[model samples]
Target: MLRLAPWKVASILAVTFLAVLLLVPSFLGTATVDRLEKLLPSFLPVRPIVLGLDLQGGASLLWEVDSAALTHAQVETLRDDVRGKLREGRISLSGGIAVLPRGVQVRIADAAERAKALPLLRALDQPISNAIIGTAGHMLDITDVGDGSVQLLLTDAAINDKIRRAVTQSIEVLNRRLNESGTKEVNIQQQGVDRILVEVPGLQDTTEVKKLVGATANLEFRLVADPGDPPNEVDNLPQQQGGQIPVQKRVMVAGEDLTNAQTGFDQNSQPDVNFTFNLRGGQRFGQVTSENVQRRFAIVLDGKVISAPVIQTPITGGRGQITGNFTVQEADNLSVLLRAGALPAKLTVVEERTVGPGLGQDSIDAGKRAAIVGGVLVVCYMLATYGIFGVFADVALAVHILFIFASMALIGATLTLPGIAGVVFTIGMAVDSNVLIYERIREEAHMGRSIISALDAGFKRAFATIIDSNVTMFVAAVILYLFGSGPVRGFAVSLGLGILTSVVTAVTMTRMMIALWYRYKRPTKLPI
Candidate 1:
């Protein structure tokens, strides 16, 4: 028997509040969770362990972004910009600049032209500003000194940094878009400076996701020749005569005018994507149609012509239809893509897997069965060995589990098989504290101490050992969580929380019960 002070009683109550936090949300659902989330301080760390798709029977996607292609396109665009600036300055050079494997070089007719061209090249640099321009005899060699280049020898580090930042930003944007579409448990990670990995759990329409992710949404309005029209004798139509009404030809509107799109049935009962454009797109379409009536217009997406229809008259309603040879699924996917827009860089599907809901349910069931059996066995063994004191420890162990589960529910941590195994392992370890205490009590009793004296001494002597063991395990779990990935991290989470709750229940709650019992019905003889 032992006596607990008022401070100890208050401490026990405070610890019990943690149990309430864990269990209340589980029973009440997300509304309570939302309230708790807002009420909790921002600095208070309470991030829950989210379940992976394998355990939850959801969708997993592996996408690879083509950073190399993106880099090449960006570099080419920069080169063109630089060339335009050089031409505008009217500085005649011996040869046009060429992008080399290492850097860029331009041969000038004279050393004076090279020196005059250096400032113009530097001014044209929008992305690569720290360019080292030097005259190598009659030729000027331009090398990026910044750490931003994609090539090995080019020292431009700024562009490389920008690429990494852009990739990260793109992932964040994609994550927001997917989340808006109600996808849960999404994991978006940058696989290098250029590639990205997106995992969306519970999403079945992977094709739709791919389409949405692939589009760059770069809307451009261009006038294209109708296929029905005779091929233009000239290679390219000279710039359209400004303000001149040339013979009306077929005109087409691009997808940029689209504000919203959906999959619906056409009059022929065939699946089609219906689109509505914003005011700008609608006005542009209406003008093109009004001016080019009786001519054919082509609808294009990502450079490929999808449809061509004759302009009957100006359409001002801001709405249009895309009729195509489409199946129901195809139409739905196209609509989804159009609505989501497109990614800046293309995303290639690197890996994919779908787990059925049935498998997840089975795992849940098996986990529950194993946990119950293991917990019951642990409780029974502890009670049998420690007699009356053991029963008190068993009660504390029960409280520990209650708090553990409550914490999970409160934080919305997904319970998986490995997580369940963590709980079972905790159950086996929870007895260590009680066992140490009981052994110390027995040793004191053998020394002929009174029951109350032995009980007090036992708890006091065991406290140091209990603290040392649990703290070391807790430190190990923290390290595991910091470094481990996926399921291994889950195990670490449960173990760390278990050690915390076990100490509170075993030392605080059990001590209180023992203190109250000894105060009222003080026993001289030991039960063990």
Candidate 2:
């Protein structure tokens, strides 16, 4: 246990040097880090510690999914599906399809058509997987009411599945939107079944963040309908400027087919959003434009008509542009929304808060004081208790703290107030393993054992106890991380890492220092 190889010493020194190097950027100013980034080699990591929202101060938003809007959209889609199925089967409806909150109903005039429609509509009952039992359930429940009426209702399982899917898609869309807008270290997570929690650090504009996340950004292309078109075939959508425009209900191309979108200047030097479509959308767009030359094409976004232009010629290049008297920022925002795609459902702001930097600085100061006081007390107690060996332990404790922060910076983990508490708590625990070893060594020396024999036996015997205690603490940290959220997770990370670092510095590092001391001085009596 007292043996120290030359390779082992080299490795420990190398790791210590790297830890110090990795930690340098955390103490430097942002401009200094930027300058060093250019001068340093590409392989060296210059990443500084990332502060959490509570530390850096930013926007905190809680959004809830619009269940009513989702239901209405789903029912509208079902009504359209029912209409198509009846038309395809050559079954005449007595009246128009009636839309419900969660389903659709249609009445067929003839009994024979009803029987044919019953089977046709039943075929639309999609098979969905039951997540709880791992069984299959139908998404739509088809029932034959009295007379020639048939009702199709959406199942509870289907509604819940759609809500869950919407929440997941919304998170992904928000992540992409925020990241593209250059918002770094943003935290977006699912709070509950229908709510999302978004915390963005260092956000300057809360309104822009809200706008970026709130807009549904649903984009569609429809043909401008003439006055003679059927009522069911046209929809009067509000225009962005004013008034209303009648557009065909059948979408010529949807935003889903968009492959890329970017902000650019038009021929008139006005800000505009340029977009490209995928293969299928390109073919459909070309076909529509070729068939409807000189007709107006209306661009609808979120149920509002943004622009309508006459199709002079077929656009076969799969590219298009939208110009709507937009400023530079508006054009950029539109491009970002288009590129991020549309949210599955509308999200309303349920709660909003902004943390200021003053509070964060106070938190930092408080944490610093707690850590410094705790570390000083530990250093004094160890030095007074174990003398020269305590100095070795103090050096190891400092290295242990360095390892914790360096590892966090290397992995880009955010540090919160709770994380600081975790680190402070770790300061007390860092000396426990050393105290145990020292006590064991003192007991062996009192038993008339030689100095080297006492040191070796003490380390070998105390190592098991050290491993057991750290293992239990590490397991608890793992559990906390798995089950907790946000700040709790931050605490778990620091505590877990501190356990590992404490083990290294307390056991290996202290033992190496003691072994080197013994080899040079050949002490007649152990220092305890």
Error of 1 at 177 (Å): 13
lDDT of the candidates, in the order given: 0.66, 0.87
Q: Residue 133 of candidate 1: its Cα lDDT?
A: 43
Q: What TM-scores do the predictions have?
A: 0.53, 0.62
User: lDDT of candidate 1 vs native?
Assistant: 0.66
Q: Lowest summed-lDDT stretch of 10 residues in model 1?
A: 239-248
Residues 481-522, model 2: lDDT tens digits: 777766788888899889999999999999999999999999
- The positional error of residue 310 in candidate 1, measured at the CA in angstroms, is 56
After superposition, candidate 2 runs with Cα above 4 Å error: 41-43, 61-73, 76-107, 111-165, 168-195, 202-354, 357-364
lDDT of 2 at 374: 90
Ten consecutive residues with minimal summed lDDT in candidate 2?
A: 178-187
